[model samples]
Every structure is written in structure tokens, then in C-alpha cells.
Target chain A: MLDNSMKLEFPSKSQNESFARVVVASFAAQLDPTIEELADVKTAVSEAVTNSIIHGYENSLGIVYIECEIKNNKLEIIIEDKGKGIENVNEAMEPLYTSKPELERSGMGFTVMETFMDHLEVYSEEGRGTKIKMVKEFKSVSIKE
Target chain B: MQLHFNVKDENLIVRFTGELDHHTAQEIRNKIDNKYKNDMLKNIILDLKGINFMDSSGIGLIMGRYKTTRANDGSLVLINVNSRMEKILTMSGILKIVKVYRNEDEALHNI
Candidate 1:
């Protein structure tokens, strides 16, 4: 019973990360989420989009697909990238483990997404692509002020 | 994002406005590093009052600055950290290394 849904395709560029966050946050705004909740969603979305750009595409040009759906108080977000896929997801998900450490990455992207979202699922095949599906259920809807 | 720098004694106070994320982290890092190199500042005080949003990249930025300050035998402190950002810092194990204060006055007094 989805109230509304959106799918966006943007270049795998660092600048587009902010654009992805804005789109997801704005779409989730209909849930009447609090400022903190909205920030959480924005941060999670930013991490996912950044991972796709930095890890998936590795600076090469590609397309990052983002799909967002809202059903009741629950929001589902899916970010996909068709580029170099993860060889070992478990290692990639480890804290402080980044393939591009020279880039000064903290390697906490997936951890932050997991912490902020209610549920997170990662699916990838080497040389294929990676798709991250995250869900967040708002505790209580706020009335328009 | 907008960054304001104020030097007091040997301390450098950086006030950040707007979101801090991967997109803006590199520019912010370069700016701070350049300022640190050219100025005689010993300590850094990051003012987070104007920052409404920050992701894990923010943590990396703080950590990198902390290392640079320590290398120069100086310290890095944080001020005006909202609860949301504080939570992220705490989770990332940054609070254990960096000191946090309520305002610039307190940070300046201590640093």
C-alpha cells in the first residue's frame, strides 16, 4: 500500500550526493518526521550515495539509481550502482575497513546507514553491481505546523 | 557550506555553516590545512552551532584535523555540538579522543 514512490537516476559524481540526499529527505517529509528523523534519513542516504560513487564507480562515469517508496509511516529506499561490485561484503561492512583508505575515507558509511535505518540489506555480485535497500519506520507522525 | 575562521591567541576557531558531508569534506579539509600551515595557530576549536547536518565524513574531517594538531603538539576541541551530531561523534569513537565544550568561551578558556 504505497502512498507514493520516486525513482531518480543521477551521475556517479560526488556533487550528486547532496542532490540524492535532498530528494530522499524531501520525499520522506510527507511522513511529517521530526528534524532529527529527517536528518537521520538524509545522512543515511548520503552515505549510500557516496559509497556508490566512491566504491562502486571508483570515479568513473556511471549512473546511480535511487528508488524511494513510502507506505504508511514506513519509508523504503533502494540505491543501486552498476559498477565494480564488492568482493567481500562482510569485510566491506567492517568498521574502519576501506578499500580506498588513501582517500581518507573513514569506512563507516555502511555502519552509519545501518545505525540510522531500521533495516538494511546489501546485495552484490562481483563485476555486476551492488544494491542497498534500507527501511526506516517513523515512530510518530508530526502535525503540520 | 560556509566556514568562518577566527584566531585567538594560538587557537584557531572554525565555525561551519550548513551541511558537512563527503561532497564538502575535501574542500573544508584543504582550507583548514592551508590555514594551519600559513598561520601560527596551535589549537583548533570547531564551532558546530551553525551546522545542521553532518555525516560520517564529518567525523573523518575532525579526526584528520586532530591528527594534524597533535602532530604539531597542539589540541583540537569542539564547541556547540548539537545532540544529533554529538550522537554520531560518540558512535564513531571520536568523543573519546577529542574534547567538547559548550561554547567558544569555554573552549578558548580550556585550550
Candidate 2:
């Protein structure tokens, strides 16, 4: 029963992204994922965390929470922000999509998450908050040579 | 990320250091695109010697630069890949399009 889950809290912002990724990667070690799988997880984490920092907080200060759990051979990550939630999650999930293109964001956050993970779910409401749930399957782990 | 820049026969040798996740991707893209706009760059040698991490965003960044260089009739070469990122690049089908060199000098000399 290695169904361990971690709760993470960070100040909502982009600068702390690297820090958050490292933290999440360390917690996700139980899956014994391949380097590629790890990177995929990290990227999905980045997309969600970036969304929390950029879209959720809108550059304002807030609290971001990430929860991870391993269940049924799948790694589940939940990134939530207590800030202005997305109005249209469907529109936000488009590839190469970005509400703020000037930021050099590919706007492919959800697309990236979907591409890397086995599945992704977004729950949001305007002016309330947003929660993103992602599940990635660990089939065969391959260590780096 | 760390960048090592050198000039060889007017080609730009930019070696990346550290992770190439979403955080550093824009900087890399902008810097290289700026070079494409300003410099008389004939070729590019991306030395991935120190890059321990990369993702699909990095993949997009690479492909975008590949198209830019190909349009300019210049070439883009990747060198000194680590084990993991190399596997990703291989599976992503980048190896078929972009030439991989064993080291920086080979990439520079090959182009």
C-alpha cells in the first residue's frame, strides 16, 4: 500500500516554479518513474502551477496547493488556487492557447498536460477558484542509461 | 539555464546548461530568434551537454528553431545529449530530422 499523498503550499507566482517542480518530483519518487516520465510529470506540474501563478492569481499574491497521490498504478496530481477562477476552461485548454500571449506563454498549458498525462480534468468558476486534476499512468519504468 | 556561446565560421554555438522546462524555454526561443533576425548566422550548434532536463515545451522550442534555420538554408545540430533527454528526443522523432553530434566540435565542424 504505497498510496501516499503529499500536500504542498507555495506563494502564487512564477519564480517559485522551479522550486515547486523539484519539490513535487521528490515526492513523486515512489512511482520509480523513468526520466522521461519524470519530465512529463514535471511538465504537467509546470503547466498547472503556471496556471495557478499566472491565470489563477493574475499576478496577485495567493495560496497555491498541490496534492499528489499514487493509487491504482496511476499518479494523481491536483493543483488548486484560491483566486479568480477561469471563466471558460474549454477555451483555455486549446493548443498554443494563451490569454496573455505577450508573456511568451505557448498557451498550451492544458494541451501539454493532456499530451503528457493519461488524463486531465479542470474545475473552475469565475471569481471563485480553480482546481486542476491530472492522472498519469506508470506502465513500464525505464531508468536513464 | 547556462548558455555557452562561441563563433565558428559564423555559426553560433550555444550550449545550454540546467533544465529546459517552461521557465527557460521562452528565453531560449527569444534569444535564438533574435539571432536569426540580427546576426549573419549560417548555422547553429546546440550543445545539450549540461541540460539535465527538458520537456515538450523544449521540443516545441527546438522544432521552431529548426524551421527557422531550415528556411534560412542554415542547419541546426544537437550535440552532447544526456541519456534521458536523448531518449525523449529519439522517441519524439527529432533524431530523424535533426542531426545529432557526439560533441560540440563535431556539431560545429559537421555543419
Candidate 3:
């Protein structure tokens, strides 16, 4: 359906992790992505939202904002949280480097997003908040040779 | 998520259904851990055939369970992991430490 955009704001509860992923996946379906592509988007969205709930907000009640846009065959998602921002974006993105290891976090959130999506960018301030911008290109909707 | 547990000897075989994510991981972990302690199970056999979706949180759950099993001198193995889930597990490098089986029998034999 051409290009479209949507925004969602929800409480930073663990339960909304699934909700965020499903909403993004449903919107991404307009791109006619394959099962695997859909799964990739869903996984990436889940990772971002989970990070907002557990790390950004520190598991306390907060707000998680998600913006999704489908442009041609490309889908861009921005997940932001007005919570405790990340101190080090690079270190946080490193695989297996979880600040909350006691919570059993695998620390693969950013890694998963980088692997599944075409582009990923992180913007954060020490005490402001964290924002994740990710873009994924769908091969299924690309022009054929 | 729903967990079906079967205890045989010192092994706890759990078949997980539904999505495994941050929302459901705690409940699933608690239930399995409780059963493992109450039944004194030494090993954990995770059957993931019924899992429709999973993310990195699934990896954390597995790794946590693996740690728990190891602490008790036991083991953890996975079975019926679809290619989709296998990709995530492989990306996380968990496959290097955990073993995967074709079915419950194979996991049972190996564990």
C-alpha cells in the first residue's frame, strides 16, 4: 500500500515487548516480505523494545515510543524511551556484554538488530533517553532484473 | 507460553509452546526451575517444536538453564529447533556450548 507511517506509545512493561513486535510485523507485512524477513523484523523489534523496558527504564514504569514507516520495499523503525539513557552505546551494542547480567540478559539485543536489519543507529544522552533507528530492506518487494 | 514437563529419573523434559521473549521467559524459567528443584532433575531436555516465535531472550533462557544444570553437575540439550530458531542460536554462538538433537530419544541418549 505505497508508503505509510504509524506511531505507538506504550508503557515500558515487559508484556508490551511482544505487542510491539507483533504491531511492527503486521505493518511490515504490507511489504510482502517472506516468512524469514518477517521473522527478522519481529526479532529486531522485540530486542529493541525489551532493551527499553529492562535497561532504558531499568524495569520501572516508563514510556516506550515506536515509530514505523514503510517506504517502498524498505521499512524503518524508531524505538525510543524516555528513561535512563545508555552510558556507552558502543559497549552496549557489543555481543555478550550485558549490564544486567543478573537478569540473565544475553546482551545480543543490538547485535541482533544489526544482523537482521540493513541499518541501525543509536542516539542517547546520559540522563535524557535512548533512541534506536533501524531500517530493513525487503528483497521480496524489490524490482526484478 | 506453556510448558509441559515430564520427569524421568533425574531428567526434566520440557516442551515449550508459544513465543519465548522477555515477557514470557520469566514465567517459563520459574516454572521449569521449580520443577527441576522439586524433582531433583539433573538434566534438561528442551523440546522446541511447538515454539512459533523466539528472540534473543530465548537464548538467555537457554543459557540460564544451562548454567543452572551445570551448577548441579547436570546438562542441557535442545531438540526440534527449526532452522529459523537455529539461526538465532547459531548467531548467539550458543550452539557451540549446547548440543542439539533430532528428537527426544536422541537428546535422551546423548544427555
Candidate 4:
């Protein structure tokens, strides 16, 4: 059963990355997640939001949509951007492969998300946009007496 | 994020407080690089005791500094990494290239 959900839309700017991370972490707090779990979610959220700002919009102004839902012990996050999408996700996902090396990007955005989350799915069309959906299950759900 | 730097011998110790994300990585990189260039520091010791959060952008900042230090034949070390930041650094394979120390004294001694 879906107990709670929230959606947020903001400009694809670097500053908003922290905002996204805090919002997601605060929402996940209701699940009584451990500090490590919260940090994992926050890190994953920051990476997704940063990608949307840098790669999706190419630093230009665009909208980034973030939707989060909690079902039982699972937390699902969907980040979508309506901007220049990826050409080849496989190549993009490769570690240390960055289109904008000049920006000093490590090209580990997707890899970090994959490592910290239980499941990650990315969908993109070159001219359209990119959507990243990730899910993580909370392991420390507090039981009310 | 706030950054403070102290120069000891040829080593530059950078202490970071608050979050390290894309918003602050570029600024931090520029500041550190500028100091490195101006002072010709040979080693960099990153004090991570106050960093509560970090993302991939933080990794890029460290890697960039590592390259700069290597180019100058210097070294970079990390100290006081909390468990959370440790996990991120470990997963990113930064622990392999950059050495981690439990205290500033240890890092300075090795550098």
C-alpha cells in the first residue's frame, strides 16, 4: 500500500541539488531510516539532481521534476528532466567516461545511484529528455508498541 | 560550505565544514587550486571531520586536486573521514589512490 508520496519541480540549477537531497531525506525520515540509509538516499538524490541540471539541461534553464513515493518498506524516487536527452546511456554509464570532462565531472553519477540504491532504471531519447527511477528498501523500520 | 586552509611546511591542510555538492565543488576546487598554485604546496591534507555530506561532485574535486598535486610531484592525503563519507569515498575507489589517515598528525607525518 502506498502510504505517502510527494512531488517537487524546480529549476535545473546546481544550487537546487542540495534542496532536492534535503527534501528527499526529510521525506524518508518518516520511515525511521538509519543515518547511513538516509545518507545513501541523500547522495543518490544529489547525483540525480546534479545530472538533470548539468547533462539534461546542459546548464541552461529547464525544469526538473522529482517524485517520491513510499510503499510499505520501499522508497521509490523518479527524477525527470525535459531537456537534451542522452545519446547512448550505455556509454554514459561507463565509469570515468564523461562528455564534459572540462567541468571536472567524475562521470560516476549513475554508478553512485546504482551502488547506493537497490534498483535503478534510466530512460532517455536524444532529443526529448531523460528519466531516472530508483528504488531503495528501508531496513530499519521502527515498530510501534 | 566553509573552507579553511593552513600551510605547514609544504603541506596545505584544507578543513571543510558543511555539505559538499555540485554547488560548492567548483568553488572549492578553484580556491584549493589557486592556493596550490600560488603557494606551490607539495602536499594537501583534506580534513573531513566536519563534512557531514558529500556527493560525486566531491569525488571530482578530490580527483582534480590529486592530478594537480601529482603534476607538481606532490601528494594528497585525507584525514578524519567519518563513516558516512568513508563509505562514499570507498565506493568511488578513491581510497585506493589517496591514502586515508585517522588524524592530522598521522597524515602530516606521512606527507
Name the candidate that leads on lDDT.
3
RMSD of each: 2.0, 4.6, 1.6, 1.3
List where candidate 3 sits over 4 angstroms from the true fold: A142-145
TM-score of chain A of each: 0.95, 0.92, 0.96, 0.96
Error of 4 at A23 (Å): 0.6
lDDT of 2 by residue, B1-99 (tens): 877677777788887878886668878888877875677787888888788777655666777778778998998888888776775566556678999
Of 1 and 3, the candidate ahead on TM-score is 3
lDDT per residue (tens digit) for residues A23-137 in model 1: 8999998898888889889999999999999889997999999999887789999999998999999999998778976667888898899999999999999999999999999
Off by over 4 Å in 1: A142-145
TM-score of model 3 vs. true structure: 0.97
Q: Chain B TM per candidate, please? A: 0.98, 0.92, 0.98, 0.97
Interface RMSD for each predicted structure:
0.9, 3.7, 0.6, 0.8
**Superior candidate under TM-score, 1 versus 4:** 4
lDDT of 3 by residue, A47-78 (tens): 99999999888958999999998877899999
For residues A69-108, write the lDDT of model 2, one tens digit per residue. Answer: 9875688899999889987888888765578765555556
Off by over 4 Å in 2: A140-145, B26-42, B56-111
lDDT of 4 by residue, B1-111 (tens): 999999999999999999999899999999999998899889999998888889999889989989899999999889998888888788888889999999999998878
Per-residue CA lDDT of model 1 for B1-111, tens digit only, reads 999999888889999998899889999999998998799779999999999788989988998999999999999999999899888898888899999999999988888
Give the lowest summed-lDDT range of ten residues in model 3 chain B.
B1-10
